[model samples]
Target: MAESAIEVLGVVRPVAQVRHMECGVVLRASDAVALTRAIGADELLLRVVQRVYLLEQRCATLSAALDALGASLRQPRAQAGAPNAAPLEPADASGVASEADAPQRAQQVVRCAAFPRTLEKRATDTLHERGFLVRPSNYDALACLVYMHGFYCVGVATKEDFGGALWEKPRTASDRAEGPSEQKRARAVHGSQQLSEDGGGAAVEAAAHNDSAATRMRQTSAPVCRAYYKLKELGSRELVAFSDCSVAIDVGASPGGWTSYLAERGCSKIIAIDPAELRQTEPPPPCVEHLRQKLQDALPGLLQRKGLAADLYCCDMNAAPSLVVELFTQAVPLLKPGAQVVLTFKNVYPKKRVWEAERDAQLDRLRSVADDVHLVQLFANTPRECTVLCRAKQSTEQ
Candidate 1:
């Protein structure tokens, strides 16, 4: 594909060559701080900008890179105020940088999440040699030198630059999981702020820095299953408000990955319907009721329970499309209008156009009974897999 840049930024960007879009990080060429502010304003571009680092230099050695970085901020500004009034060396950044004001904003610890573990040690050593004391925790790092691949990305960032940041991959500090795709953009964002459902400039900016959302499905603790990350992102994105949700229904909930997430999100009651066993069954959560039967068999008894109307329904079944459609149609009456629905289209497996056709049929079936049917590719999902999201439109009483 041709090297390109979006119309708004006016800067040509290089898209990373990665298998999945979620893992592919795009590096943008920027000239001014205003360019970064522009990216924060664009929602579509925000997804690609998981992290933002002002690239001071990409030197052959870590020491050389730090020397170059110090030189840039050293520029004598007659005004004696912000460091960025004069254009900083635009390395390979395409996204946001914290606005310049206080001088201490530049204090950053040195770090890297790229491959070749040696690079991380080398960068830290070089920073230490240069008098940058190692912080006890990544969160305590006000800002830091971040290395990716062989590129030396160092610069000044905000105080919370490293605080509560998902700088390292889960269970390890290595970036091997991200591979070379981690080197996509020039500007880097620290651990991104918590996700916000309320969309606007702030949310876009916050999300731009948080790679966790872009990476999707990161659990702070051990997960029941990989599916935990999907629902985690859902709550992070505000697609499903788990905090307000009281009752949730999990269809085909074997091994209870989705059900486990529902309970973690604070759902007061989760009815997991599956023929097999859930991993959560060892002790079984008090909040969960396991109905070990098919959706069709368990649904009738499930509905008769007093004062029960589920506010959320999640269906992740690996069965025939028509059968799923049949079961969902039957269960649609159990929801009140405005209830949220999430389903995984396992049929998206690559076989040919046949799978595509199957996915399309399911889309049509969902749209007939639900409002705002949105097809989304969650970060936790494989390239061939996707998820269907919608809200119930009609009530059973009607």
Candidate 2:
């Protein structure tokens, strides 16, 4: 089989946007091929697809689906658990899956709907019944997504094959220049297919990525204010360990949403910079020092302090992207080498393409002072807003 062997099974609708957003297309052959062609071709789809599935069988009922699934699995799988597809033309030594593609476990996508809600138990049972090992894994999963009407689609791929799988999870220095994964390029090449301007077919044709975070965000509650939940969601991945930072600066920390998060992380010295009263300070956060002034004025006072260095600087200031970046840039000089920064670019404008284009331009400015800048549209964020993560330049790892 070639590396770029599998086709998209169908539109994988995330449950949250099934009714509200433009999605919920049932996967069909024509749509899958059209979507497959667009995978690397379309600027959007390249970031959207997490995994490619070779549709083996689809059944209406959960039991019948697994029964058919068992039969498909019984067939000799591609050598070393490669999916039932041809490889993209081999590129180099780095292009191979090697042992990374080995059959691990049958995992399920966290976003899509599951019928009978007993999907996990039943899947475990079927794998056991078929005489297969069932060691579950989130890193490299042979995933299944159950759509509306008990529709089921099972596919095989590895963490590398779906190289974009972790793209949204975290940011790293190497990822800045790493265009696409070598394994991804080796297995899947761009097909020059474009979705028609009339988005009727695309509603269900090209579904979005899995792991919808918006649903999780709505379910979350915070003591200070809802803004606290943003950092809670941001740090939940453990990619940027907030606990490692002893000192932090929460810009625009009024209602104290983000300030509360730093306290929870056990950050020793926190400067809450804002003019408005901090509602969370009524109780007076033990680790926080409230700077009751604008950031520019607060900077002079903060510099006078004998030992002033920040390990983390976080801002979710409700302002234009340009103003936000400008304010964030001013604080870069006060940070310890390699201090991490987090900012949320609010969706003040209506269009994604326009804001995103402007967003990247602002991010490039950070290049002078920071490296490994990442712009991600998080599930926890509002529809158009995005999260930016970067490390201060000229910093050594602590």
lDDT of each: 0.55, 0.55
For each candidate, C-alpha RMSD in Å? 11.0, 15.8
What's the residue-level lDDT of 153 in candidate 1? 52
Against the true structure, whose TM-score is highest? 1
- In model 2, the runs with Cα more than 4 Å from the true position are 1-221, 395-398
lDDT (Cα, tens digit) per residue for candidate 2, span 330-370? 78767888888998888677787888788878888867668
Give the lowest summed-lDDT range of ten residues in model 2.
200-209
Give all TM-scores, in the order shown: 0.52, 0.47
For candidate 1, write residues 1-398 as lDDT tens digits: 02223233223222442332223232443332444555454433443344444444455556555555444333322322131332233343422222232244344443333222223345545545644553323322323344454455555433232222322323211222233223222222232222222211222232223444324424334455556667877878887778877988889887677888888888898988998978764577899998889988887786787877889988878776666667777887777677888888776345858888888888888788888998888766645568888888764442
